[model samples]
Target: MTLGLTGLLALGLATSVLAQDYQRPSISGIGAVAQPEQIAAWDIDVRPDGLGLPVGKGTAEDGEALFADRCAMCHGDFGEGVGRWPVLTGGHGSLTEERPEKTVGSYWPYTSTLFDYIYRAMPYGDAKTLSPDEVYALSAYILAENQIVEYDQELNQDNFAQIEMPNRANFFADDRAVSEAYSERCMSGCKAEDINIVSAAPELDVTPEE
Candidate 1:
């Protein structure tokens, strides 16, 4: 097609704009490097060995009121969970049952996970708002509710690693690499038996009809 004067000018302008965008100098110093203190603020992960636990202490007694105030709406008074929310207590020795009730006391392999999770995320809409002491208190309360710790027993960084989960022995490192069966990749003519279709989608009445 023959280009009109206006079309030619528009095309030239677009090409020039594209060329300018491609050749534009990169921006410099848009943001400063993060300071050590600033990086420390976000590096708040607590390890299984209680390495990153902050200096603080609290008891289940202190946590009960805090739980009611900050967490009861969804978690219930005793951590039985409200509606569809997660149940935090009970479910002991139920792992072998047909339907296991996995709770903190029942299935969690580490207590550090509980503390870390509560600290990083909790209180529904508001996350990371709880203080270190408050987090300890909440952890203690949940532990107490699960009968893992006494109600008045204080929890701190020093003794936190000593508290073990009931299901800790059940969990182990993945051994699929060594334990599971591995074989060479198979393509065509791998199976000795002939393949047969058990049923069709139409016969099973699973396909939607127009």
Candidate 2:
């Protein structure tokens, strides 16, 4: 059977309707359709504006204890990073160095990132096992260790958006207006910029050599 574009579209629509009618899909042997609760469990999206933060509050002091107990084995007692593990603090003036050490305080541009990452992926082997309150505590502790937040301050969804990252001011809008070619080119006299010769084929070299 030869299927034209219209036939192919009809086939796709029929397949969609079949998928809707049947709870389980069997074409590729995907046996189950996710329930709303299942989808919610996996659909964790932390917005940059801190809108999707869960209802939970915690303090840096509370976070320090949690971090020491749950995270220190991999992250170190002070967020200095365990041996061969990720470092989460310091490196404030190292971006210009030959081998820059980018820590959470020195490079990350948002407070939400700290909350989101630790909530989703942390404690090395265990991921997404921390409760919302525990995640908030861990987030606050890391922020305090990196000197972004006071060790006594409580962090929650209400105040999370107010927390500013140290690298926030460094990022500016990318404006390539001057770099773009918007008008007709002056092929000769205006061509003063550096030009790299990308390839050379001796047989295809048609220009006269001076």
Candidate 3:
């Protein structure tokens, strides 16, 4: 197809505008290097084998008070969960149910995982602010709440490895192969059957129609 004089002028203008939009970033190497102290501050990972655990001690009795003060607003007393929050206790036998309640006690495989998670991310808003002793106490409280330990139990770096989770047997070492496929596995009661709608959306429609 051929372009008229006006069309040619228009195409040239568009090309010029596109050329003006492209700009290269400055190649200046002007950033400071992070110090070893700063890097160590952020490298706070705890391993499953009880490695990297900080030196501290806490009992379940001490944890209850700390949990109530720092965690009860979201996790609820006894770790039952509060108002759309995650339930931390119970659901001992609901893993195969339609709506599985995956709590720390019912699903997690290791106590170290619990300790690591809380140490890195707990109390919702405040992250990595609790002392090592506080983290131990909190872990004990949650464990006690789930009936994994007695209220008088103390958890520290020395005894953290001894506490075994109930669902540890459910987890197995990975054995996936390139040729293996899940389609060959028989999943009973997974067929498409008509079912009643027991629950529904809220009556108040806040979504836009358009």
TM-score for each model: 0.71, 0.65, 0.68
Clashing pairs in 1: none
For all predictions, the C-alpha RMSD in Å is 7.6, 12.1, 10.0
Please give the lDDT score at residue 117 for candidate 3.
Answer: 88
Write the candidate numbers in order of decreasing TM-score: 1, 3, 2
* Most accurate candidate by TM-score: 1
Per-residue lDDT over 1-210 for candidate 3, one digit per residue giving the tens place of the 0 to 100 score:
888999999988877745577887887888778999997888777877888788898989999989999999998988899999989999898999999999999999998888888989887899888999999999999999899998898889998867889998998766675445456655787668877877566665766787
Better of 1 and 3 by lDDT: 1
Per-residue lDDT, model 1, residue 23, is: 69
lDDT of each: 0.92, 0.85, 0.87
Q: Write the per-residue lDDT of candidate 1 for residues 1-210, one digit (tens) a residue.
A: 898999999988876755446765789979999999998999788989998999999999999999999998898999999999999999999999999999999999998998899999987789999999999999999999999999989999999878988899998899999999698899879889989989777777877768
lDDT of 2 by residue, 1-210 (tens): 787999999888776755457776458856798899997887776877986799999988998888999989988999898898889999887888998888889998988888778778876689888998998898888889888889889999899868888778877776677677488867767767888897888768988899
Q: Candidate 2: global Cα-lDDT?
A: 0.85
